[model samples]
Structures are given as C-alpha cells and as structure tokens.
Target: MQKRYRIKREKEFQEVFAAGHSKANRNFVVYQIKKPGQTHYRVGISVGKKVGHTAVCRNQIKRYIRQSLLELSDQLPGDVDFLVIARANAKNLDMKETKTNLIHVLKLSQLLLEAQAE
Candidate 1:
C-alpha cells in the first residue's frame, strides 16, 4: 500500500480506536470509521509481540496483512479509516490464508464496495 493510504500517526490510530466501530474473527480485529469529505481510505495494520515474539515474525505478519489489503483495496469503500490488528492465532496463517481471512472479515463487516454484476 502507498504511504498516502496508510494510517501513520499515533493520533490517527487513537482516533480510530476511540471513535470507530470494530469487528473481529479468529485472526483479526478490524476497526473503521467513515471520514466525511475524504476521497480515499486509510489503513493501519498491527502485528504485535503477542502474535510473534521475534521482530522478523511480526514484520512478516504485517507484510502479508498489508499485501492482502492491497489486493482488496480496490474493492473497499473510500473515506474510511480502517485498522486491522492481528491476533495470536494469526501467526499460524500463511500469506494466502491471511488474505482470505482478511477479505472474509471485510466482507462480513460490509466494508467492501460491492461490485455490481452488469
């Protein structure tokens, strides 16, 4: 994902956590809030030490999660700030499974912009 589409500041993350709504599954907790007058979606991904003690492991998890979101970015709605937080169980998932799980959760939360079958 591009830097423009990422949530980089501590205050932004805190705002999303405090005001956004959330949804969770076995692997991820997703928080989102609609930002009025914005034109794009901003994302944040978190893979903490609880999920993986080693830095490499945590970074790998973050990479895969961001990759998954990148693939699904076109389908997501704009003007939203969203965060995906990894759970301990997320360590067991590979890139493909991580993408699948993340997509499923996004769909469940109705965050993705549904494509019309024309």
Candidate 2:
C-alpha cells in the first residue's frame, strides 16, 4: 500500500480506536471512522506478537492485509479510515484465506460497498 493510504501515526491510530465503530470475526477486527471530505480511505493494520512470534511473521500478516486492501480499494468507502487488527488464527492463513477473512470482517462492519459483497 502507498504511504498516503496508510495510517502511519500513533495519534491517528488512537483516534480511530477511540472514535471508530468496530466489528470482528474469527481472524480480524475492523474499526471504521468516517472522514468527510477525504478523497480516499486510509487504513492501519496491527498484528501483535501473540499472533506472530517474530517480525517476519507479523510482517507477513501485514502484507496479506495490505494486499487484500489493494484489491478491494475501489469497493471500499472513500471517506473512511479503517484499522484492522489480526488475531492468532490469522497466522496460519494463506493469502486467499487472509483476503476471505478480511472481507468477512469488513462486510460485518459495513465498510465494503453493497455491490462488492460478492
């Protein structure tokens, strides 16, 4: 994902955590907050140590999340910020499963557009 599309600062993450609405499934937690006037959505991803033992593992999880977001970008709301937190079960998932699980969580949060639900 591009830098402009990522939530990079601690304060931004906290703001989303404090104010955003959240939804979760077995593998992911999704938090979304509307940012009116913004032209595109931004996302923050977190995969804790409990989910992955090492930096490489954690990064792999992040990569999966980023890739999924890239593919779904056009289907997501342009004026929202999303924070995705990975759970322990996520570590074992491959790319397809990661995307599936992420999509499920996003749908639960109503972050994905209606026409994109398929």
Candidate 3:
C-alpha cells in the first residue's frame, strides 16, 4: 500500500477509531470513516497486544494487510479512509486469507464501491 495512506500516530488511530463506523465479522473488525476530499484513502493497520506481543508477528500481520490494500488500491473509493483493526483471528491467517477477509469486510462496510468491486 502507499505509505501516505498508512495511519501512524496514536492520535490519528484514536481519531479513526472515534470517527469510524464499526462492524465485526468472522475474520476482522472494520473501522471506516469517510474523507470527502482525499483523492485516495489512508489505511491504518492496528495489531494490538491482544493479537500478539512480538514485533515480527505484528509486522507479519500488517504486511499481509498492507499487501492486500496495495493490490486493491486501484479499487478503493476516492473519498474514504479505512482503519483495519486486527482481531485475534487475524494473527495466524496467511496472506491470501488475510487479504480476502479484509476485502470482504471492506466491501461489506461499503468502502469498496461498485466501480471497484471485483
């Protein structure tokens, strides 16, 4: 995924969490907030302590999320930011599963518009 779209700050994460509409599915929890003016979305990856404690584990999960977002980057709506908050289930999933699950939730949340739907 584009580096510009990654949510990093503690405050920004908090804001996305606060600003977004949330939903929980079998695979993940999605937090979505609309950004009307942004030409592209900013996605934040959060793998909290409950998921794993090691950096490698967290990075692996995030890498899976990022790679999925990168593949679907061209498909995203122009005016939305997505925050993918990882659950315990996300910790062990392989990249393909991770990507599919994330995309599924994103579509369910209506972040991926019809123009972008695959």
Q: For candidate 1, what's the RMSD? A: 2.4
Q: Which candidate achieves the best TM-score against the true structure?
A: 2
Clashing pairs in 1: none
Worst-scoring 10-residue span by lDDT in model 1: 109-118
Q: Kindly list the per-residue Cα lDDT of model 2 for residues 12-118, writing each as its tens digit.
A: 99999999999999999999899999999999999999999999999999999999899999889999998999999999999999998988898889988864544
Sort all candidates by TM-score, best to worst. Answer: 2, 1, 3
- Alpha carbon lDDT of residue 98, candidate 1? 94
Clashing residue pairs in candidate 3 (N, C-alpha, C atoms within 3 angstroms)? none
- Tens-digit lDDT track for model 1 on 1-118? 7899999999999999999999999999999999988899999988889999999999999999989888887888888999999999999999988988887788777898874222
Q: What is the C-alpha lDDT profile of model 3 across 1-118, one tens digit per residue?
A: 6568777888878887888899777768888788788887888888888898899998999889888888887778778766888898888799888987887888788776643444
Please tell me which model should have the higher lDDT, number 1 or number 2.
2
How displaced is residue 32 in candidate 3, in Å?
1.3
Where in model 2 is the C-alpha error above 4 Å? Answer: 115-118
Which portions of model 3 show Cα errors greater than 4 Å? 115-118
Which model scores highest in lDDT? 2
Please, what is the TM-score per model?
0.94, 0.96, 0.88
